[model samples]
Target: MMDQLLLALQGLRRSRVWLSIFRREQLPQTEADWLAMNRRNFFVHILPAKIHKGSTRLSYNWIWMGVISTWLFVILTITGLFLMFYFVPSVERAYDSIKEIMNSVTLGRFMRNMHRWAANLMVFAVFLHMMRVFWTGSYQKPREFNWVIGVLLFVVTVLFAFSGYIVPWDQLGYYAAKIASNIADGVPYIGPQVKQILLGGTDLQQPSLLRWYVIHVFFLPLVIVLLIGIHFWRIRKDDYSKPVEYERGRRD
Candidate 1:
């Protein structure tokens, strides 16, 4: 994945994709080396020579952030699959299956809670880590594209929340769906059309349940996986990010 990202960027960089905006000499590297980065940027370009070679290996923290997010995604997938065993999309059966999971399925209650909490924590952690990266200027210069990738990851996190919100089928979930559908209906000229597509009519009913389930169980997860691949690829392509100056060598 990282090799692919590098190759893509290598093409872009060679073509001087940011020529008009960032300018040739504005970047700290020699233009020829960047022509295809067939010439690699030396450590001297970004770091002092005194640092040991091993210090530049990898960021265990960023890798761990990705690992934790990946783990949460796997947990959500497994728990969601188990929940599907009992779940029915009909409004009547939706809430009942939730109750059944809570009461009847062995350890279902704990699994549900753990899945839910992990999801919430994953969002929070991603936000905090993103903020940390931003404040540290991890998104600078050659890394601007990866910063865009980071923003997309944030969007995927929200997508997960929106898709997962409808699973319980309680009064709260029902109303939440209604409100969300109404927002979908507010998409300017396409508002009503979007609502019609999502709701399958003017009101929430069977079609709405099915639509949300398809997005939740299949479509959105596939998109998330694609975005994750891009995210990890960017990390490797740009090389590990540098910690903030104040936090440098502090064991982040």
Candidate 2:
């Protein structure tokens, strides 16, 4: 039975339809084949053809926080879109729209909660991932540029959270925006201009809400996605950083 199953699966993999989708009849079995396969496949091309064993260890990587962060971002994007269908960005209606979503829309509360928590967790996970890289000396030499990119990504992630935090326009969100704009207003030379750009005025109001909504839903997502693509490409180019090892009495 097992033999028959294996033969049938092999035949199916070689079928014209499968070949059309996968663009290959069989898995790569040699170095040249692997290189050709990675080059020919878009998804595979983004990933390393080979990875260091140390890079895969849980102890060294600390729970794969980078992957977790990426998955959480995905979750937030999906749930945020679902919530957007019911959310109104208008200051007057924003809070009520949130209420309606919670009380009336199907699974709305669940998705909103998922989005909220995922946003929070993404922030946490990204921070931990950065720390892990720093401690593991993964930011050295050829990876310095990627480290800078990662820092930019972390900043943008924080901005993503902060912008989304103000969308509901409730008292909590309103005060949060007020505080943030005030901080922006304290920048050394461009304080007022910065605040103006952020709030669209001197105070938090309709325009502020609308601007943040656009930023949270559109601008930030675009920036983060671009940054992530670059970061991944850099990883593939530079190769994964192997964890440092120490002997009891000697250092290599």
Candidate 3:
């Protein structure tokens, strides 16, 4: 029974969509390298070095980017949670609270900066990774469904950035919210109302602060969590593809 279970797990890893298309491994090659790659026959690249008989897929990279993204978010969450203890979420107190954090709390500034930077980095990394997957045609056929999940994550990331921007309650954040809500007013029939609801009026003010807080702290974060969970699980179900040819041997 244990052996069968182990085989089952191995099957899942080998079949991950992440391994077959995006990951590449170093393999031995002749000194007579083709494509002017004489000095570089097998070194490194994106796709893992493996041959597939259209059935026997070899092992792929297990460092799931999806999981790494989640880990980054986890770091953000813990750091953000610590931040909330110091944050008051009000217009008048917001700036003062930030100062208090830096001066009073031990390593508070470091934690806050880490959370902010990690959130930004997570979004940026996810975007680049998505582009890599798309261009490499990793979303082909059996993986198309997870590609959809990727799209959701993209939107979630935008929402995360937007909502997070307002928490600082800075002048730029105020204007940022104003412009964003103005765009929301272009949503057709109910656009005006949505603009009002989101901005908490026709202007960016206190109500806007609370609204964005609810979204960043409560609503959209929930969606991100849900979508991220599905994204990882589905990748496990989707088919992992293997490269049929090599692009360039990494010498440099």
On lDDT, the candidate that comes out on top is 2
In candidate 1, the residue pairs with backbone N, CA or C atoms under 3 Å apart (3 or more residues apart, or in different chains) clash, namely: none
Order of quality (lDDT):
2, 1, 3
Q: State the lDDT of candidate 2 residue by residue for 1-252, as single tens digits.
A: 999999999999989988889977767889999998897888989878888787888978898898899999999989998998999999889999999999999999899999999999999999999999999888876789999999999999999998887899988899889999999989999999999998988778789999989989999999999999999989888878887662212223
The predictions' CA RMSDs to the true structure, in order, are 12.4, 3.8, 13.0
Candidates 1 and 2, the one with greater lDDT: 2
Ranking by TM-score: 2, 1, 3
Candidate 1's error at 231, in angstroms? 0.9
Which one is best on TM-score?
A: 2
- What is candidate 1's lDDT per residue for 142-218, written digit by digit as tens? 67898888788888887788767886767777887899888988898999999898887888888888888888888
TM-score of each: 0.71, 0.87, 0.70
Report, for every candidate in turn, its global Cα lDDT versus the true structure. 0.73, 0.89, 0.72
TM for candidate 2 is: 0.87
Taking all chains together, the TM-score of candidate 1 against the true structure is 0.71
How does candidate 2 score on lDDT?
A: 0.89
lDDT of 3 at 45: 20
Assess candidate 1 and give its lDDT: 0.73
Candidate 3 residue lDDT tens string, 1-252? 999998886666567563565332332365333322422323432122333453232223224455577788899889988998888889888867888887899999899889889889888878876875676566776677889989889888878887788888887777878888988999999999999999887777788888988888888878988987777656545534434242222111
